[model samples]
Target: MTHILAKYLVDARYEDLPANVRKEGVRTLMNWVGVAVGGSREDPVKRSIAALRPFSGPPQASLLGRTERFDIMNAAFINGVSSHIFDYDDTHLKTIIHPAGPVASAILAFSEYHPVSGKDFLNALVLGVETECRIGNAVYPNHYDVGWHITGTCGVFGSAAAIGKLLGLSEQRMVWALGLAASQPVGLRESFGSMNKSFNPGRAATNGIFAALLAAQDYTSSDGMIEAKRGWANTISTKQDYREITEGLGQRYESLLNTYKPFACGIVIHPAIDAAIQLRNQYHLTPDMIARVDLRVHPLVIELTGKKTPQIGLEGKFSIYHSVAVALIDGAAGEKQYSDQAVRDPRTVALREKVTATIDPAIQPQQVDMTITLKDGRKLHKFIEHAIGSQEVPMTDQQLETKFEGLTDGILSQAATRVLMDRCWQVESLPSAAAIAQAAVPQG
Candidate 1:
């Protein structure tokens, strides 16, 4: 299985990608850059830089949204952390893996160290996302249910495959890279709602680069590390569907399945938040007008975001109660809605207390049944079959631009943000892929 995947990655070319898949790759890059720049000044990023800057080697690549540069590996790690800090990166709905954080983060950083064409970058990005998401599909609920953060664990393969492609590794070397990546899986579900949660993707990006670099040097490992009896699949999961990894190598593109988050929280809570925001906008409702906000959601929503009272912004992101409350009170759930100040606001707190959720097995994770009780003895019911950001209902390009603008509002000048957005859209045409990173940093 590992050998077959490596060969596929080695032989895949930009010209083979379908038009829609390539377009989605561009969109993924755009969303990732927006979030990374927006989250550059976040506390976790700041602390990470402060802690690692001293140990970092000579600067080889730019860190998105900041002036400082670091070694390619460190740049990948930091940018990966920034992209995912707000829980706002793109997601593969089936695996719940934020594909770009681990894959794009590594390859973009590597682009700085070694100049690659935009086409090559995009191709690598697609392959990387495909590699991880397929592996993720293979071990999903079992790997995830066992407390492994699937993104961090599966993401390393993405990083390795992407970097390996750029490095022009032989099929054997690519297999070795995968083997090395298998030895290092970072992240646990226990780290959710904390700074450490962001650390997973960061480390995955770094580890993949490390694996690929070593493999390029002929670093050796068991070739069947991914599918052996005691390998990653069997060791980490009870069920291993190797077919998911090799069945449709070039024919199926998982990158096209990528979905961006409209709200800055876990994907499972999106339906409820979408329902709340729609009802709030439709009725022009205020906290005083809302008697109670009731949600009948998928079991995963409460299992993942059941926090009744979230003390901080990150914690609030994992709370369906808080997400719905803010969506109803503010009519939107942007970064501001999930901020420390927002979570602690008296009005938000009071409204969140009135929000309650019940799990329904029949309700799909992307569907929600909501009822809003009013102070005037009126009840408003909304049943969301699919959330706005789901694959069934994707965010429009204009909506994505609006989301980009909102995230970068204070962090970057309108001019700079626009330039970055343009570069991201024009990535495939750019002479050097590093131009995106250069555009991401604020000018003096």
Candidate 2:
């Protein structure tokens, strides 16, 4: 009668998550808040918040973008969407799961309605992140290759489990919640460049909450939904090591492995970002000096981030060529690097056209190698063993703070941003979850 999934959920809520996990969980939340606020001005986020204004629920949670009495579900939907609008949210490359948006959005919605403590909110986040990374690891080559956005699709179950833990669901009930979540998974890579990209995480937060609520009401789905023959495995997996999901569930903290995004682009291009940054700094290279740029990268990155003619910010965010060009010209890659101006810059666009990538099958998705040939016929080679913000080289507290402040500077003033960052750092000791949520998404 022991359900490993339920045990992990309950234990994570009450005990298993350590101090570091809680601290990191809140940090992830803080970074997510930054992206959501920054995305407030994004056309995609604006359009959806505007669209949902007329479909208000109960004024449960504050939509970060606008001043409206949005329901908890709508609040989650909008917040989740905005978080990924710029593709700046944190990533767990090992699982290929976009962790922050879905988990933070779901927790924000829950916090508005319930008066749970920040420590408990952190617990739910840790649990949710675990579920997210686990599923992503299990699917591996097969599920993601089939064109499913794992962050949005599998993220629902993680969001549901986290919400369930926060609501204090029983062990059996948490299992039911997972089943309910499994039945409604949705997301497609085909929708990458459109508004639907944000839609995936939005639905994940809303539906995940619904699944948990329904399960608490004794809603039942197939008992073995996760590992069942015709369950997630059969429906979503291929060439996947299903065993990876359960192997380190209780022993290791998966959220710790999550990578923070420095550039508002696909994680696959992160190595390219590192390499570009290296080249930019080493030579203090100017765009005019670079005659032609060539990138030797993993085949997976080539497939995912090889957009050659990006016309918009979102499209540029997914394009390696554009990102590399901007980093080289600007000397730094920031949220602005993905702005319309940056994306549509004639200089950047022209430089991007000169940059070409060749596939290297040996270089895995988690890594990238670059060999840049400058106009002077000088070759600059940079091997980014790991992206800067990844677990291999995690962002220090000071760095994460700088990222939060820099990203939220104009949006959230110094005083407000400091308060939010401080609260997240010691979330385990906060008064209540509502305090954390309010500090994050203030009414403007």
Candidate 3:
């Protein structure tokens, strides 16, 4: 049977890919690198890397943003963790799958052990993203509504497929890889407010890479793992819409639909940030001028971004109140806004107390919207038909580069930053994957 996944992974043709698809792939790579760099400074990622010191494996791979090296799996784990440390990684808004976390993390780590050209990097990344987004779209509202982390659940399959392509797996063997990946799909939304959140993708990166390696050796599994009644698609997911995956196949690329992020918080908070930023500029209001801020949103937003009095950095990302306050006060929402000190600031806490969300049952049926009322007798309201990065207004190349530089600034010297950016832009061109692995390591 030609399943949706098989149609894309096995039968899809790459002849008609649009030009911008390739450019977007590069943009996502840039964004992911920036996220990984920014995330390296996170306390959880630091602790995780520091904890790995006892393993003492050969330094065969590079962990982006850190000089520490480990086996490919460990390296992928650390890099993947760092990418989402701040929840700043790129996203495919439609699926809510953070594509770069699993795809870029696994591919970069695998490249460290296996050399492939920059063109190949682009191709492999493009394919991985297509696989991920398509699967995400297929089972989306149902899968997510039923409670599953798509990035961690579908991510391993996509990451494994990408790596298998680089390893030149036969179509049959690729199917085996997909089956192996399906058996390992894992991630949970319950961990969103804590470090368990980032750990999902990192673990998927490790599992995905390992799966591909095993499949390349002619490892075997049931070919129908994705569609079997008791298989991955139905067991762990709510429903299987196979056409979404098989419809385009290779005739169209899924990567083009990927969205880049402009902020470093949960995707649900973006609409509120946009609304708040607008109010900040139009009202010319400083933090002192604001009396109260009220917002309306979908229940998911409240569930995900509803941390009322977040006490820590990670918690701040999930706090709609804190995120809105940061956008209005700081005029920007970046890693610094989520710093430990930022959360404890009295002013931010006070602002959080004033902000409250209305669970409008009407809008809950279709989308998320937010309205803010200010003390100066001005009311600013916006119906966020779509969030900023929902494949609606993607971050431009210049914007992405600016973000990358900012994240890697002190961590990587100007010259090194330039080198890494160039390497990522032309990743598939490298004669040795070792070049990227070595380049990603932080300098002492």
Candidate 4:
């Protein structure tokens, strides 16, 4: 199984990708850059920079959106954290794995170290996304149900594969790199509301770089570490279908199924936010006009995002009620909507309290049935069969560009932000991947 994967990775050419697949890779990169830059100045990112600066090695790579540079590995870690700080990165809807943080973060840093061309960088990215999402498909709900953050758990494999490909590791060493990655999954659901939640992907990216670098120097690990008895699959999950990883090597790309978050919160809360925002716009509703708001959603919605009253911004990401309240109150659910100020706002708090949710097993995870009752006894309803950012209804390129602009508006000058965004879109034609990284850093 390991050798099969390595051979495919070794031989998969950029020309082999479908046009849409290649385009999606650029889209993924563009989105990752935006979120990383947007979250660059967050409190968690600031603390991480302070904590790691004392131990950082030689400055070899850029930290997207910031002026500081660090060793490639530390740069990868910091960039990964920044990209995911808002919880607004790309997701493989099937497994809810945020794919880019670990994979892109690692390779962009590696590109700085190795001088990878944009073509090769893009190829490695598509392959890395495929690697993690396939593995994610094999163990999805089971692995996730057991308290693992699927992104950080499976992302190490993606990171290792992408970096290993860039390092030109032979099949034997690629196996070792993956073996090292398998032994180092880095997240738990218990960390969701804390800074540790973002740490998982960052650590995964750093670990993958470490794994690939070691393997490039002839490091050896169990070749069958992923499938061996008591190995990753058997130990971490009760269900393992190897076909998910090996059945469709290059023909069917799972990276194409990647979805970006329009809202800066958990996927489970998107439906409610979508419905609420639509209702708010339709009726121009205010908190005082709302009597009661009710939501019927999947059981997982309540399990994953049922926080009725979030005390802080991070906690707000996991709150279905808070998301809907803010979306209705503000007509948008961006990072600003989930800020500590928004969470503690008297109007938002009151609206959130008025909002109630019930688990409806029949409702799809990406769908919500929302009903709003007004003070004068008018009832409004909106059923979101497929939320805005779902695979069924994905965000468009122009919309993604808008999202990018929104993220970088205050951080970079308008002209500089546009230049950075254009570079990301044209990444495949660029002479070097380092150019994109360089453009991402704040300019004087």
TM-score, model 2 to reference:
0.95
Cα lDDT, all candidates: 0.93, 0.80, 0.79, 0.92
Instruction: State each candidate's clash count.
Output: 0, 1, 8, 0
List pairs with backbone clashes in candidate 1. Answer: none
Per-model root-mean-square deviation over C-alphas: 0.8, 1.9, 2.2, 0.8
Error of 1 at 29 (Å): 0.5
Model 4 poorest ten-residue lDDT run: 1-10
lDDT of 4 by residue, 116-178 (tens): 888999999999999999999988889999999999999999999999999998989999999
Error of 1 at 171 (Å): 0.6
Q: Candidate 3, residues 5-119: lDDT per residue as tens digits?
A: 6445654333445668878888888788878877886777878877886884777788777877788788888889999888898777778899989988898888877776777
Q: Tens digit of lDDT per residue, candidate 2, span 1-444?
A: 116777767765446667677667777887888788777767877787678778787788876634554788888888899888888888887767888788789887778788878777877888888887787777765788888888887899889989998878888888888888888787899888778998899889988999899988998877778777788757887755656666777678888877788777888888888888888898888888888877778887768888888888778877999988988888667878887778889999889988888888878776777777877788888888888887888888788788778877677778888887787776778777676557665445
Better of 2 and 4 by lDDT: 4
Pairs with backbone N, CA or C atoms under 3 Å apart (clashes), candidate 3 = 12-250, 13-250, 117-428, 117-429, 118-427, 118-428, 118-429, 119-428
Local error of candidate 2 at residue 299 (angstroms): 0.6
lDDT of 1 by residue, 1-444 (tens): 999999999999999999999999999998999899889999999998999999999899999999999998889999999999899999999999999999989999999989899999999999999999999999998999889999999999999999999999999999999999999999999899999999999999999999999999999989899999999999999989999999978888888899999999999989889988888888899899988888898888888899888999999999999999988888888888999999999999999889889888999988999999999999999999989998999998888899998888887799998998999999999999999999888887
Model 1 Cα RMSD, 1 decimal: 0.8
Model 2 CA deviation exceeding 4 Å by range: 239-242, 441-444
Cα lDDT over the full model 1: 0.93
